[model samples]
Target: MIRLLIADDSALMRKLLEGIFTAEGDFDIRTARNGNEALELVRAFDPQVVTLDVQMPGMDGLTCLSRIMIEAPRPVVMISSLTAEGAEATLEAIELGAVDFIAKPGGAVSLEIDRLRPLLVEKVRAASGARIRRTLRLTERVRHQIRGAGLASRPRPSRVSPSPVAKIGKVGMKPGSATLPGLVLIGTSTGGPAALDIVLPQLPADFPWPILVAQHLPASFTGPFAKRLNRECDLDVVEVNRPMPLKPGTIYIGKGDADVMVAPRAAGVIAMPVPAKGSYLWHPSVERMVASALDHLEASHLVGVMMTGMGNDGAEAMKRLRLTGGRTIAEAESSAIVWGMPGELVKNGGAEAVRPLEDIAETIIEMVNSCAAN
Candidate 1:
């Protein structure tokens, strides 16, 4: 049986969630009325996975999450609303150690809750078996160091050294070429936002290539997430809504509920969002986006990165990129929140180099600059 806990201030919401999980069977359900009660139950129930509401009374979701990470340290999926504040909190919670999030549909007693049944069930199942990091040892200084200058109030020197597994190899590009490949494609999920926060801010403001990112999130959350990233990153970050020319020193984030695709236009390669089909497991699928870019751009012109995420959505596509002479980097297991995505890539012989999260930006910078210099 899957040991599960649901924490919400609304009794109706808690009951509704309980019914959903119970209907799935093999689930031992426990409920908590608020954050304080949730903490108590966490100690007593010892559930494999927990679903926490962001706006609970008596400690609230964020406080409860911090406490949970500090105390019990289990996989947690946050229940968030579609509002901007909810999106911000959800991102913060993920950084704090939550595995994923489910957007609350409608209100506390919303009948629209049915719309979230599929997502909730899937996320809960994933969280149940997730590998969570130990946050108990992260002091304020350690956190600032791990997350880089992006999340902290004070400025610090960025580290850009290569990891033990990083391969500093030669790019097979000729010198003095007018048209060189200058597109960076990054795909991540599960624990992607936190990884992005670390990497995006490390790139210099004059980075020559345009970056396209596909992260699994809700449509309402992507914009706010991009804004958060923009505040810390030296490059301009925006949520891509329509077909726009790719620009240097800018990062384009795909819409949460859509698949990001690239096409060659007269101006340049432009990114746009396509509505996700029902068959797709990952919204804004990393595989679909990278594959689209591969169709139009040469492998040498692109740098493909697979970060901390679940499943192998982009692994096969990354393998193809490597075969065609593209530079590929997979996030090392040591730094991954979940190593599924990058692990699959390495298993399939898709990656050229695998580096820890802290070294990824430095490796990318070095690779891009080398290509430009050659």
Candidate 2:
């Protein structure tokens, strides 16, 4: 049986969650009215998973998550309101070790309860087996520290460059690659939602290439994230399913358990799934996406963009793009919330260019236009 602790300031919400999980069966439910009570229950119940609300009296959910992770380390799912402040705080919780989050349903009790049932249950199941840790190293400190010193913030290329375009053709193109000029592969995590908000909306509707994104998010969050992105961007943003065809001006988000890969089919471009066992530390591996794009698309036509994220998930993949004659861009540190992943790529010489979030869309569009003209 799975054990769960539901911590919320709302008695009604606590009861509703209890009913939903109880109806699902196999759950030993525990409830807490506040973060302090939740911590007490954690010591006694030792539940396998926790569903914590971000706004509670006294200690907030993020503080509770930090304490829980340090004291007894267990997977936590943050329950947040749908407001902007709530979204920002919930994202902070994820960075603090919460496995995922569920937006609190609004409106009538019946409607809210019904909408959250499936998500609450699914997150509990996913969190029950997750590996929770108390601490993670932040490696981008050196880069941030160096910038504070008056040294040139951007790394100077060892060799003097005549022009930015001079390095363009040094990476040779592969045969029979896809010829679309607007398609791009984007990888992001940690602070992705905010960064994506800054980046995606800047893309023009006529942007020719399809976008394949691998954001480190759990299953339930992906739908909401896609919906949010779709509303913000001019392009059609949707989560990719098994055998879904990739189309121009469309954005495909990788599913939680599946590694999304692109391959040319007789009918056109299709997003396919690979088994999950060998996927990198994170699910919906970025490496799988980048390598798959390299294998299937003509290198000259591919543009890989890595945004603000934790860990070095996209570094090696970006290196492969550099070797494959594809353009690679990393989010500049000043714009990145965490900067671990992109910082690693920039440090390792994997990224061809480093730019702030605002410039990524324009840079990508320029690369596509340049390749098309060539």
Candidate 3:
């Protein structure tokens, strides 16, 4: 059974969340009215997952999250409002070792309760089994430094070589075999729903190439996420199935309880779902997806884009993508809800282009066109 601790100052909010979790069955629920009370409950209950609100009467959620990472090292999901300040604080919580967060809907307890039901349940389940390690002091120090310095104006590397243009399938003119997207991989997290909504719908129907997405999401949510994307986008998007063939304009989303990788098959590409064990310390690992894509696809035709999210999950992967002669783009900070993931990529020189959410679709289309032309 999964055990959870709910920490919030609002009496009604806590009651509603407790009621929801209790109704779900198999969950042992505990409640805390403030950060101090939450700490006490943590010591007493030793819960598997914790849902902490950012604003509390006494110690704020960030402080409690920091202490929890130090003392217990359990999975924590922050509940924050959608205001700019709330978003900034939530990002701080993530940096302080909170695994993920859910944005409170409409700044109201009732509306948030309704909109967040699915996310809350999914996060609680995912957090229950996560092995959270004690956060190192150095990590926190580095995060503080990065935040203080402001990452927006960091210098970017000059493009050494232009991306090769490649065309695939019936979408466009057949390029001389030289130019083609060798591998197509995407990474997204928090704010992915809205960002993908904007980007995917703009992609033309029958666009050629196999696209793999590694969105940081719990297993229960991937199926719905893929379906939602499929409905809005012209291309086919589906949760990955083992041994499935990789085809043009089809997207395979990594789903729950497994890490999706691509392996070369005599017939074509095969979806390899590995046990979660160490395959992904976190769900929908961007590193695993990017590494697998690079190994399976030719270097010259690779393209990697890191979308909005908190933390640096995709940073290393983006670096690997760059080393292999692939084109890489990151969602610019201004357009991102959290900016932690994409900002890290930009700071580390992993992204070849930093673009707003509105421009991502056009940028990708241009990249594909460039590949074809090459």
Top lDDT hit:
1
Candidate 2, residue 96: lDDT: 56
Instruction: Please give the range of 10 consecutive residues that has the lowest summed lDDT in model 2.
Output: 157-166
Per-residue alpha-carbon lDDT of candidate 2 for residues 196-242, written as tens digits (9 for 90 to 100): 76577776676667789988765556666677678767789988757
lDDT of 3 by residue, 133-226 (tens): 2223335545546657886332211121222324553321123222223456778776555466556666666566777777775555567667
Task: Note the residue pairs that clash in candidate 1.
Answer: 181-301
By TM-score, who's the top model here?
1
Where is model 2 more than 4 Å wrong at Cα? Answer: 1-52, 55-182
lDDT of 1 by residue, 199-292 (tens): 8888877677889999988898899899988888879999988877777779999999888998766555678988996766897888888888
Ranking the candidates on lDDT from highest down gives 1, 2, 3
In model 3, what is the error at residue 190, expressed in angstroms? 1.8
Mark the regions of model 3 whose C-alpha exceeds 4 Å error after superposition. 1-166, 169-181, 277-279
How far in Å is the alpha carbon of 211 misplaced in model 1?
1.0
